[model samples]
Target: MYSPLVQPAVSGASSGSRESTRDNVLNSVLTHGPVSAATIGDQLQLTAAAVRRHLDSLEKDGLVEVKSVAGSRGAGRPSRRYVVTQQGQSHLGDDYLDLASEAVRLLQEISGDEAIRSLARKHFASLEQRFSELVPEDADLTDRIRALTRTLDEAGFAASTRRAGRGGKVTTLRAAQICQGHCPIQEMAGEFPEFCEEETELFARLLEVDVRRLSTLPTGGHVCTTHVPLGRRAHASLMAHTAQRAEK
Candidate 1:
């Protein structure tokens, strides 16, 4: 007899703990899939059985689906893989997705693309203003970048910053890269790339420096990357200050 896997709800078990585990499993699939239950278990340090139980729940909830991969040799059974469904992807962020998309489409139909672009710019400007307040006027570029990354992460972008080049008397150019691991409005942004453009412009204004977007998630890049030049003049001035301090 085939029996469905039953997860017992323990009276002593904390709902918060169970919810956290479920979220971790979902996030693992969201970030690193189409993957196998075994892979998810290894990444998340959950037992294989536990991972499958969570996967089953996710599948039942319409958040994940199983895919079959061909066996290495023709004789064996195909391997089962798991991938997030469209509904699953949407569940990861932006609850008002349909409404937001519809609103953008209606705005475009009513007022044209420029109106949509204007709205995007205006929307992102609020983010800029909020982030600007968090970073002090005297904060250096790195401090500003860190502050912006923190804000993005809190807003569910999973953003991080990294420095690329050496900054010294010998090196005149340096750059910082901001990588957003996820975008809440990736689907909407695909249809309205103005969202991305407006975001890039907003970033430049907030940083008070020129920045270039290298890639975006909507266009199939793994992450959204922005390149920010620390400026040769700023580097030269810092080097000069260092030399003056050494002379003193």
Candidate 2:
């Protein structure tokens, strides 16, 4: 029913393909969602009429949703807003999760949850260890967390950090979102045991942080949670992004 979002295609104007323009419009919507047609035209330098034409094609293909937003306060009539649909999102990336999911499924059939958990923990540990090494030894806890948070953001986790409680508390870095649509074998990683283990291991290596299984963590039913500490300035650099993102 629900498919992961796909990455936008690369378009070259010389190719003489309308697909490129359509793709551009689609990408525009994805980045600035629920946007008005006029707004889209203004940003892309396309006329309102041209924007409508592209939108028409996208709507017909079930790639986007056009909703009428009622004006707020003393505003005038409703304006149509466009958003990329889940289907279109799935087409955005190279499907790598499929293979990983398959392997995980096989592992579950042979070993069971205990073995999978052990493998996953090692995977996460390795990630933390690598990132920890990159952090400066002289830096305080804040600096260390910041460095790690930055690393996670670079790895594609929408991460952020904040100071909570009295005494400025500790810098708390939180990953608001993770884009795994393009992950190799993403679907399989959740469904199968071996694939799950591999995926966890891979994420650890890629992000250089421990990736804990959802079941093992306090996330309830969520698939997984990766932690990046935030007590030092060095760590804060990584965690600092959270504050920067919040401002935006």
Candidate 3:
């Protein structure tokens, strides 16, 4: 049973199997990202240790990233979720990126910049409305912001939220940072930044508090970060949007 030829064959087969399993794990993260290691193990029928091993390799290879998702109750530790990165997307065979970029260029040439802006606004309108329904009207800024990131995660943004800035001191600030680990329209957004701007506007309108873009995936950033000021009530923003809608 310990023959030399058989040893090579067995080693080759074991290596191939490992590679296959690793690929499967990466695909799962890409498809359902902002997903947890436990979820990945359940989906792929792999052991916890096995999933962690694959994830470590993927992270080392720049193929995946870990994001921290806040707990709903805000009482427990944040969960670590995995998302595929730009480099990972390439390995997944993103063949249409060039085509998408080309189409945006053509649109810009034919329709002008306002058209792109209008398209961007239209694109995020549904998201604004959806978030309105997803979060409670009485929810505070913190709750609404958390809901927003979760919605973005489901929409392929691979999003997460974390509290930032210094608190509990004189003249210090407490803010929330919404980080998007992936962007489905990274190429298109690069050509027409209206997409990103519109998203910011949407966040402002939905959260009723000011939001700022810290970085973006299109601008060579590994992740897109939006800076949101905290300690504001959602009702303030809600009333303003309501009045604006009535005028429309």
Candidate 4:
């Protein structure tokens, strides 16, 4: 039963299987993050101990992070939700960003800044079409913003929405901000700037309300932040949106 070659082969296979399971755990965290460990275990059909083991490895490696929230069962213990860190996203990998940035730079040199602006505009127009279709025509600003956030998440932007406020509490101001933890084209956008401008403009056009970029990932902010006014001039914005659609 103890053949040298066969024993090493079995050991290697076991190690490979463990690595595969770890990758699955990491992906589950990314897709359903700010999610609890139990939930991930259930989704992956892994035991609690197994999931925790993988998560501990990921956390130790700086690929996963945890947030403690008040547990519903009682206040004595808090539930931990896991989300991938920026480094974790890098682990997921974005190949050729450097090459893409060089391509955009070349385009700018050949065609000028307006050409880059036009390219950016055209680029986001498709995303606008895809994201807008996910929201209802009469949805309120909260629902609308959340829909956009959902779309962004599905697009791998790692986006989340939060009510914009000063201090730690929700602001009285009627505005919310969309925070994207990861941007696929961050490297390229940093050089051109047109991509960010066009994306902000796209949000305004889709929401039919003026929006602002408070900060951006390329600008050295932790996340890309966009300020969206909530429930202001809804009717006017709707009318403007309708008019724009008609003209197009």
Question: For model 3, what is the alpha-carbon lDDT of residue 248?
Answer: 37
Using all chains and alpha carbons, the TM-scores for the candidates as numbered come to 0.61, 0.46, 0.65, 0.63
Best by lDDT: 3
Q: Name the weakest run of 10 consecutive residues (lDDT summed) in model 4.
A: 1-10
lDDT, candidate 4, equals 0.71
For residues 61-153, could you state the per-residue lDDT of candidate 2 as single tens digits?
987887677875758988788866656655655365566556655766798866565555554454466666767656654454455555443
Model 1, residue 226: C-alpha shift (Å): 1.4
After superposition, which runs of candidate 2 have C-alpha atoms over 4 Å from their true positions? 1-17, 67-78, 94-96, 114-248
Off by over 4 Å in 1: 1-19, 25-88, 165-173, 232-248
TM-score winner between 1 and 2, please give it: 1
Runs in model 4 with CA error above 4 Å? 1-56, 59-86, 166-172, 234-248
- Return the clash pairs for model 1, or none: none
lDDT of 4 by residue, 1-248 (tens): 00011000111114558987787777666655666878767766777888899899999999988978787677688889887776876777679988878888898899999788878877766677777788878887666677777777667776766665443343336677777766778778888887998787677666666678998767765567788876564357655764563343
124-172, model 1: which lDDT tens digit per residue? 6556666877888898876778778777766677566666666765543
The whole-model lDDT of each prediction reads: 0.71, 0.50, 0.73, 0.71
The better candidate by TM-score, 3 or 4, is: 3
In the order shown, what is each candidate's alpha-carbon RMSD? Answer: 11.3, 10.3, 11.3, 10.4
Clashes of each: 0, 53, 0, 0
